[model samples]
Target: MRAVVIEQPGTVSVQDVPDPIPGPGDLVVAVRGAGICGTDIHLLDGELPYDRYPIVPGHEFYGEVVDVAGDIDRARIGRLVTVDPNMPCGACAECRRGRANLCERYEALGVTTDGAAAELVRVPAGLAYDLPADVSDVGAVLTEPLACAIHGFDGLPRRPQDRYLVYGAGTMGLMMGLLAADMTSEPVTVIEPNPSRRALAESFGMRAVSSPEEVDPDERWESVIDCTGVVEAIEDGLGRVRRGGVFQCFGVTETDAMVKLRPFDIYRNEITVIGSMAVHNSFDRAHRLAQVWGDEKLAPLVTHGYALDDYAEAIRTFRDGAGLKIAIRPGGLA
Candidate 1:
């Protein structure tokens, strides 16, 4: 099996590796489509808090089940499925409290373990969800990221008719805008500096602007989301929240990064600030949504695709912000 191996931070290679053998209660999947995420870049640059080198780096993926462990149902073989990569320690207090996404002992595919940037990968059967036949390959691959966006919505005070203001028009921000559009009758507004991204957001029917200044200075949103993971965006978004509104930090940022906030303003305005981590019992719902929106909406988000051997090019394309969602097809592009 050929896999993308990150020998260490700043080092990557495509090399032959042993085919994955499923452990008990696990299944081996022949990789089909895998989406490259910003976290992958972080892993490559050693920006993450922990180090898991010599590891394959892909988690947003789906594929056909090629084999199953002895304990798993044999009928699962050949089924197309999407996996939830976050593996939380079931015994953790957070898990007990139904907040497993914040598990103290966190391990996830592509982060702490070898993942789907390969011809074959092993995943726990419990984490795998059978993707509906109606879901396109692009939709199936997006289940993980959509699940994270769903979790982000779960953290919001989702009142009916609440307006949404989102920072960044990148993949995650666009998804957030899509979800926000569905949640309320109000138009969703997205702030994106890139002209192309802003145009893409407008094509999706969202109000897109180059900066907050472009929007009415007095305008405020009931739900403000910062998806850029940028300090400037986060700071700007905080000030745009309406009185008693909720602000969610949906993007990943440096662990030590700090943003200036007016504590007094927040206290007086009764604003709530929250952070959404990863998937939390949302994969199945995201998969269902993908089935509903696959060809019509979700699939269009995948603007680029690459063969497994072209992982380097995929990374470059992603870093250059050349497309919306870039997929790596380990089994070759369809």
Candidate 2:
């Protein structure tokens, strides 16, 4: 099988590797469509603490079940499915509390183990969800990220008519805006510096701005989310949250990243600041969202595609911020 292998931090290669074999209760999927996200870049640069080097690195993907372990149902073979790549150690206290995403010994397909940036990959059967007929292949590739965003809202306390302000208009920020619009029954406001991304956001009928200054100076949002993972964006977003409003951080930042917040402001404004991580019992909901908002609503986010052999090109495109979402088709770039 051909795969994208990260030999180590700053070292990557496309090479022939042994075909992944399913373990007990596992399924072998022939990779169909995979997405190259920020996490993949982090894994390549050795930025994530969870990344284990010399690993196949693709977490967001959907495929057809080619084979299954003896304990699994044979009926699952040939089914189109997307997986929740998060593999939590079920015995951990966090897992026992049903907060598996924060498991002490957290493992995932692309981070700690080999992932689907190959002709085939193996994953737990229980984590796989069948893609609905209404969901397009491109939309299926978005399920993992969408699930993570859905989990963001799950951690949030929503109020009817709450206005949302998202700090970025990239893939995650766009998804957050869509979800916020649905929940708040208001046009989600977005701040993006990139003209292309701002155009994409507006094409989705979102109210976008180049800077927060463009919005009414007297106005603040009830809900503010920082999806850029940049210290500047976080700091700016915190200041824009209305009094008694909630600020959600849904982006990933480096270990050493820090921001200064006025403790007095938080106390006097009654502001609530929260952090949201990966998918937490939201995979099924994400699959359902694909059914409801699949090709028409979400697939537009995909603006680029690449062959597995062109993983490096995909990474370059990502780092350049060339598109909204870049898809890796294991079968072919087309």
Candidate 3:
């Protein structure tokens, strides 16, 4: 099997590797579509503390089951599925409290082990969800990220009729905005520095602007979400939350990053600030949502596709912000 291997930080190459063999209770999938994520870039740059070098780096993916082992049902072979890459230690204190995303011993497929940026990858059968026949390849590929967005929403107050202000118009930002629009009657406003991204957001019926200044100065949102993972954006978003409103930190900022916020204001205004991590029990729900919106809303978010051999180009395109969602087709397009 050929895969994109990160030999170490700042070093990556496509090379032939031995095919993955499923262990007990696992299945081997023939990779169909794998989406490149910011985490992949972080892994390449040694930005993430959990990432392992000499590892394959794709987690947002869907594929066909080619083989199964142990107690897995043989009928699963040939079924198209999307996998939840996070495998928490069920006995951890956080997992016992139903917050598996914060499990003390976290093991994500792409980050901790070899992943789907190859012709074949092995995954635990329990983590795989079968996709409906009508679900498009693009929709299947987006399940993971959509699940993360859903988890992010789970952390919000979710007050009915609450206005939403989101920062950034990238893939995650756009998804967050779309979900916010569905949750409220009021238009969702997005702040994106890139004109092209702002245009894309407007095309989806959201109010898009290059900066917060473009919005009414007195405007405040009941729910403010920062998806840019940028310090400046986070600070600006905090200031735009309405008194007694909630602010969600949905972006992945630096571990040591710090921002200025008056502790007194949080208490005086009764503001709620929360953070959302990776996928929880939202993977199956995300797949169902994709099935509902795939053709109309979700699928359109995918703007580019490259062959597995073109992983380098895919990374370049992603870094350049050339498209909304970029997919790597390991088995080529079906």
Candidate 4:
């Protein structure tokens, strides 16, 4: 099998590797489509922890089941599916509380283990979700990220006519905007400096602004989500939310980044500041969204596609501040 391995920091290579085989309660998937995520960039930059060097790095992907372990039905074989990349220990306190996403013993695919940036990958059967017939391979590949966004929204209290603002028009921000649009009529604004990204956000019928300066200081958002993971965006977004409004930090920032906020501001405003990590109890919801939203909704996010062999180029395209979502088709897309 051909796999792209990030041997270490500042290193990536496509090399022949042994095909992944299913373990107990596991399934082997023939990789179809995988997408680059911001976390991947962090991993590459040595910001995120992962297994030792030479790991295949991709978690958001869709594939056909090539094989399965245990007594699972044969019907599952050859079925198109997407996976919940969070592997949780059932015995963990978090899992016992039905919060598997925050499992005390949790290992993420592509992060703790080898991922789908290859010809084949093995994952837990329990983590796999069947893809709807109407869902395209690309959309299926995006279910993971969408699930994360959906979970974040699910955790937040959203009002029907609440004015909302999203910081960062990247994959996570755009998904947040799309989801928020379906739930609220209040103008959903996206703040991003990238012209291409802002244009893309506008094309989705979202109010896109190049900076916070364009947004009226008096215009207070009912809710604000910072997906940029930058200190500046976080501080600025906090100031944009209305009194008593909720501010959700959905992006994972660098460990060293910090922002100084007035504690009195939070106290006086009675604002609620929350951090949303990965998806929990939202993978199925995400799959359902992917199925119903169809290509019409998912189409807006996919701005580039690359062959698996061109892994470096794909990573560069994503890191270049260009596309909203870049797909990595193992065999390349037509």
Give the range where candidate 4 is weakest over 10 consecutive residues by summed lDDT: 45-54
Top lDDT model: 1
- C-alpha TM-score for every candidate: 0.98, 0.97, 0.97, 0.96
lDDT of 2 by residue, 282-331 (tens): 99999778767877888779999899888888899999999888999899
What lDDT does model 1 reach?
Answer: 0.91
Q: State in Å the error of residue 274, model 3.
A: 0.6
Write out the backbone clash pairs for model 3: none
Q: State residue 226's C-alpha deviation in candidate 2, in Å.
A: 0.3
Query: Residue 82 lDDT in model 4?
Result: 93
Between the candidate structures 3 and 4, which one is better when assessed by TM-score?
A: 3
What are the per-residue Cα lDDT tens digits for candidate 3 across 123-168? 9999999987666777799999999999998888787799999999
Across residues 54-88, which tens digit of lDDT does each residue of candidate 4 receive? 77899999889999888777689989899988888
lDDT of 2 at 95: 94
Cα RMSD, model 2:
1.2
Runs in model 2 deviating more than 4 A are none
- What's the CA error at residue 181 for candidate 3, in Å? 1.3
Candidate 1: which stretches are off by over 4 Å? Answer: none
lDDT of each: 0.91, 0.89, 0.90, 0.86
